[model samples]
Target: MTSSVFITGATSGFGEACARRFAREGWSLIISGRREDRLQALAKELSSQTEVLPIVLDVRDRAAVTRAVDNLPAKFDKLTALINNAGLALGADPAQNCDLDDWDTMVDTNIKGLMYCTRLLLPRLIAQGRGASILNLGSVAGQWPYPGSHVYGATKAFVEQFSLSLRCDLQGTGVRVSNIEPGLCESEFSLVRFGGDQARYDKTYAGAEALQPEDIAETIWWMINQPAHININSLEIMPVSQAWAGFSVHRKE
Candidate 1:
């Protein structure tokens, strides 16, 4: 039987790249995103390579995720991998000045949405047994802290811890889990976080050879294709231009 994968947030960024990467290997894809036009366009583009099922979904909705999984076509009933890439950062405001709505949106999409998809799709992955895996898109913010990271960082921190704990629970089941924490990739993520400011987006990556979506997709490809017995628990990626910063110090005058 051919291998299949489910990828969320497939309209753009890592999710879209992952879809194309998997399609290269003839893996049947169930790609979901809130943008129907983009989803359908992707499905059409990949259908020539392999089977594609485009689901117009927002992972934040538990009911919608459940329905999508429960109604998977016969060919996609069993899955070899689940890519939980449907997440975002809403704002870069400091915690005290940030809007509560932004925090709630991040938690809902980054944390809760991921949870709903993972829980709903585990059984399908388990059914595939060995070689099956769950790949989550975490971020460096989760592991490190910055001035305006606030809630977005916290949500990714949850992703890292959750991925680790899941490995423990799934040890005997042959279903592996991996958390991928990336730092500063060039994508629409920054635009969203900056509320569609093109200047901010350009400045964020200008002169910085930031990692591309394809790079992360390639990393994910290597991860899920590893030997069944070898599980990659956690991996972090950062561009050459990126590195840790010294601790901040405040002096009172």
Candidate 2:
């Protein structure tokens, strides 16, 4: 039987790239996103290569997520992997100056959303009786902090810890969980973080070489393709052009 993978946030960026990558490898896909048109377009594009099911989903909605997963078509019921790639970072202001709504949104989608999908799909994955995987998209922000990354980093920190705890819980079940943490990737990330300001987004990546969506997608593909006995717990990646930020000291004026 051909394997099937369900990926959230498939409208663009890493999720869309992953869908394309997996499709090219002959894996049937269930792709979900908030944008119906983009999801439909992606599904249509990938259908010729492999089976595609496009779902309009807002991971923040628990009931909706449950329904979407529970009602999977018979052919796509046995999912081999669930890629939790539906998350974002909003605003670049310091924590003290950050908007409360932005903080809530990050927590809702990044933490709560991931929990709902993982909780719902885990049973099916375990019951498959074959090796399966959960690939989470975490970030270097989770590990290293920046001035404006307070809530965004906190949410991802939860992801990293959660992924580890999951590995512990799923032990001996042949269900692997891996967190892919990336740094300085160029995508809709900056745009979303800056609230769709084209100038701000452009300035962020200007003259800087950064990782692409395909890079992370390929990493995920490699993780899933690994032998069942060899489980990769977590992988962190960053472009050579980027490195850790230096410490800041306040000088007396």
Candidate 3:
């Protein structure tokens, strides 16, 4: 039986890259995103290589998430992997200056949405036994914080800890949990964070060799393709151009 993988936020970036990568390897995919057109386009493009089920879903919507999972078709019901890639960081402003609404949006989608999907899918993954895995997309911001990270960093910190806790809970169930934290990836992430400002996005990545979405997709594939007996606990990847920043010091005027 061809293994099936369910990927959230599949319209673009890492999620989209994962969908394509897995499809090329002949894995059936259940891809979900808010943009119906983009999802459909991806499904169409990958249909020739592998089966694709496009779900127009916003992970932030709890009811919709539940319904989408509950209504999965019989063919795609045997899920072998769940890629929790539906998350974003909004605004580069400091906490006091940040928009409260953006904070709420990030919390809802990044934290709560991930919890809902993982909770709903655990049983199916367990049923599939040893080969099952859950790959979460975290960030370097979660580990090393910077000024503008704020709530976005907080959300990823939750994800990292959550993945660790989940690994403990799933110990004997033969289910694997891996948190994939990446640094300075070039994607729609900056664009979304800066609220569609092309200039800001360009400036963020200007003249830097950053990690690409395909790089992340390849990393995930490597993790999942590991021997069933070998479970990767967590992976933190960063490009050569990026590194830890020195602590900020306030100077006396």
User: What does candidate 3's lDDT look like per residue over 52-102, in tens digits?
Assistant: 889999998889999998999877556799999999999998899989999
The lDDT-based order of candidates, best leading, equals: 1, 3, 2
Which residue pairs does candidate 1 place in steric collision?
none
How far is 170's C-alpha from truth in model 1 (Å)?
A: 0.9
Error of 1 at 116 (Å): 0.5
Go through the candidates in order and give each one's C-alpha lDDT: 0.94, 0.92, 0.93
Supply candidate 1's per-residue lDDT for 194: 96
Candidate 2, which segments miss by more than 4 Å at Cα? none
> How many residue pairs clash in each candidate at the backbone level?
0, 0, 0
Question: Tens digits of per-residue lDDT for model 1 on 1-253?
Answer: 9999999999999999999999999999989999999999999999999999899999989999889989998776678999999999988877899999999999999999999999999988988898899999999999999989999999999999999999988888899999999998999889999999999899989999999999999999999999999999999999999999999999899
Better of 1 and 3 by lDDT: 1
Candidate 3 wrongly placed segments (more than 4 Å): none
Expressed as tens digits, the lDDT of each residue in 1-253 for candidate 2 is 9899999999989999999999999998999999999999999999999999899999999999999988998776567999999999999898889889999999999999999999999987887645799999999989999888899999999999999999999988889999999999999978988989999888888888889999999999999889988888889999999988689898999
TM-score of predicted structure 1? 0.99
Candidate RMSDs in order: 0.7, 0.9, 0.7
Candidate 2, position 221, lDDT: 97
